[model samples]
Target: MSQFPPPLRQPEAERNPLPVPRPMSGRKVLLAVLAGLVLGWMIGMFMESIVANTPNDIDPDELHRLRWLLAAAGALSGLAIESIRQLQAASTDPAYRRRRRFRP
Candidate 1:
């Protein structure tokens, strides 16, 4: 027999490592939504400043409404991003993979 001992075997996790996706926690969701809303509101304000170069160019009340619209859009975007993340995580699951369809 040779002087060298048998080689050690790697554990199951090490042998076939699988990439795991972490679920978005509530805190992350809240932060994302808040960040989106704030950013959107800021953008709306910037746009308003640009459009309202002259006092009579844009109505003050309409600007307020515009801000709300932008904020809503931003919030929706945050939700969409989170949904995509969840979908990607689900797609990695064995069950989901089995049922998932491939595009031609």
Candidate 2:
């Protein structure tokens, strides 16, 4: 019998061990949400001020709709920004790169 014991099994550290994402820090997520809300509020106030000063009168319903639209846009933009940051982090991480898509 060979003197050497079976080589100790080493865990492979190639790529993402699990596809499912683990929970991230809630504080960071909360901060992003708060920042988005503040930005949305500021945008709403700025739009109101602009509309109030405009020479042409806009329908009240239309003005309300515009405000809502702008707020929604702000939120979506913020989400997109956050997603991009997450993607960047994943791309740059060596562990993540192992699992990311490969070029042919």
In lDDT terms, which candidate is top?
Answer: 1
lDDT of 1 at 43: 88
Task: Give candidate 1's error at residue 26 in angstroms.
Answer: 1.8
Mark the regions of model 2 whose C-alpha exceeds 4 Å error after superposition: 1-27, 92-104
Q: How far is candidate 2 from the true structure (C-alpha RMSD, Å)?
A: 6.5
In angstroms, what RMSD does candidate 1 have relative to the true structure? 5.8
- Please write out the lDDT profile of model 1 over residues 1-104, one tens digit for every residue: 99999999999978865557676577766777888898889989998888788656667899999998998899778877877767677465666545557999
Q: Write the per-residue lDDT of candidate 2 for residues 4-46, one digit (tens) a residue.
A: 8897766785443544444454566556766776788778878
Q: lDDT for model 1, on a 0 to 1 scale?
A: 0.79
TM-scores, each model vs. reference: 0.63, 0.54
